[model samples]
Target: MDQAPGSPQGPQDAPSLPKCYRHPDRDTGISCTRCERPICTECMISASVGFQCPECVRTGSGTGHAPDANRPRTIAGGSITDDSFLVTKILIGINVAVFVMVLALGERFLAETELIGYAYSPQLSEIVGVAHGQWYRLVTAVFLHQELPHILFNMLGLWFLGRIVEPALGRSRFIAVYLLSGLGGSALAYLLAAPNQPSLGASGAIFGLMGAFAVLARRTNIDMRPVLIILAVSLVLTFTRPDISWEGHIGGLVAGALITLGLVYAPRDRRTLVQLATCAAVLLLILATVVGRTVSLT
Candidate 1:
């Protein structure tokens, strides 16, 4: 089995502003305080601390009884779904399913999915890795976990962080942060770790969430002490713990912070464009890193 893939032995794994709800053609970061939905400056009804959507202003209050067309939105302009944590839950399910498969299918299963720059796979009598054009491994490895504890910790962390981060950033923005963070982690590991060293896990994505949550908390003026303590410990573990991919963790942290910074702080005037540019730039950076590393290894 690919037991400790990213270690000396193992592998581990790890958008846009929204359009204005009423005027979908427009893009704005300023959401209605009452409806919590995106609204253009024209639709903004000045209220305390923030603006209210036209409907909320007309209604005189948010009754939470708006029709489905008037679904509430998140602070980041994502529609507030029935379950704010839907995406988070789905991610956990995916990780768990992949973990179960890894257990059932054994090392070959892991070798096929885990992030490796370039490595030989004995089971298939062939070389396999991102360098070999198996770039999907960069993503698959993130959901692949061979050990129980690894998945457990990651899932728990996802739930804990998702509850807050997902709702605030909205579902689409949340997904963007997560996926880019995971890729950043994988790309960094590919660049820095040994070519043949395989690693896989959700740690990168989780760390990304940690970085994001920190930013969100700060933006909302929530006490930072609690998040800081947790982050401090995680950082300590990333460095001190053996078999943990510190490169992936750090990459994720940086990616998450950068991505979320754009999402939250972007000017309402051009929030969508800025956010799209941020994601594109970060993805290009990661891809460039991977390409350079692959060239050197080959």
Candidate 2:
């Protein structure tokens, strides 16, 4: 029975009991933590850790009140947050922003005619002339898309893949995958491209996402046949499409898959860190070799 508010003794003096969410008559005094509403004995629900009001409990809702519901989830060696969905948005924003910059600065004239010196190159010999000397392009070039359709497709792939991958891998791991894939792609291009030819696109990074997905699917209980089919189709489109870099795509795919494999098979969080370190080490070695060759050629 609920004590009248005016009772001199207060809650301490009354017989404490649970109440239903709807009932104003009988005092059943139990409350649900989730909704913070009252519930009576007949309507009260015992959750994993506590009692919940009928509405919040949803008896047949198939919701097994997980004891860890109130606790945080750490999955794939990273903090799990609802905001993981937003990582895709951020990547979209970056690609769009870079495209806008390309547009604002003017197209062919700014991209091809005006040269940025700090491009990445796989060939040490190319570094001697402005034609291929800008090694920094290896990193920056990945962001440079010459056409709208190019950026559009790349962004689409990133948005789709990132939404799925980021949540599974966490923010840091996703970021690492993107950067390393792009770099690896660029490195491969540098080594393979004709000294004077300039290459740029987010294709490498997007391919990385595909590779990561493949690894993730294989490691987890997911059926990967559909994903594999999609990947194969993407490769076909890549080659048939004019101005696309097949080499970059292949390089990024290999790098992403290898990185993903390491992360998935590793013992624990240590694997995630180890994958990151391996990528870093390989990239550094490539950079050093490229830069050294460039200096010698110059």
Candidate 3:
């Protein structure tokens, strides 16, 4: 059915300019300051920042026109958000749970015997050596802390820094940072350790956080001088303490920095799944190398 010549269509089919509360008769373009309803040029008034209708400006309800008001609020000191709260909780829980297990096993097992020790020592090891070797120790040692203070400080640091770092990078990337850092630390400790001496701790991963923080600061528009100071202090402590694994600390730091660089520069608009898959591939490569070296050495 065609319309008769020069006949106006019904309201449903009519070509009407959208209604403007400010100027009903005028073609709607700009929006009202107070209600965000489209308004035409005739009824629109210029505000200090944006266009506002006369009624909205008169009523002092033209905040929509203030460009600064719509801008994101900046927190003092520019600290990153505590976005990884759940990740922090899980990591801390795992550390504490493992610590409890260590305590339950008593001082002898905790101090003298480690999974690695059992595998390496000939007299004590029978089938466990064949079943388990120094290879598994690289992963297990990451969860085993020697003393209460040792676990406490590392866990606390993990919570503090992980929360800051995780949200920005997301969980999969954060896990990659943690595991790779721990592995890197273990590798360094293995290289530096005598056959008789045993090394264990999460400090390597904690140091990784410090390194990632420094790298992350470079990407964001945040001042990193304070963070640099914190890292320097940690480095000093790592060197000054004879018992500390300085090699692990340095190794983890380097690994963390490199991994963070990869994550940050990766295209954000790309599918997160692809980047995660890439990370998993890299991690598997590192794991294969670490495990192969450990098995051969043992």
Candidate whose lDDT is highest: 1
Q: Which TM-score value belongs to model 1?
A: 0.78
Give residue 248's error in model 1 in angstroms.
0.7
Q: Count the clashes in each prediction.
A: 17, 20, 0
Poorly placed runs, candidate 1 (over 4 Å): 1-72
Better structure of 1 and 2 per lDDT: 1
lDDT of 2 by residue, 1-298 (tens): 6757876675676665655657867685465533445766676655422354555445324344545443333234554454766777887887788778878876543354222333443443223323346555667777777689888889889988887778667787788788888877776666666555567888898899899888876654356888899899999987898866787898788878877766556655375567667667767855764676455445
Error of 2 at 276 (Å): 3.9
Global lDDT of each candidate: 0.83, 0.67, 0.64
Which tens-of-lDDT digit does each residue in 46-124 have in candidate 1? Answer: 5422466777555544556767655655555556555778999999999999988998999889888999888888877
lDDT measured at residue 10 in model 3 versus the true structure, 0 to 100: 82
TM for every model, in the order presented, reads 0.78, 0.66, 0.63
Task: TM-score winner between 1 and 2, please give it.
Answer: 1
- How high is the lDDT of residue 235 in model 2? 94
Candidate number of the best TM-score: 1
Worst 10 residues of 1 by lDDT: 6-15
Give the candidates in order of TM-score, highest first.
Answer: 1, 2, 3
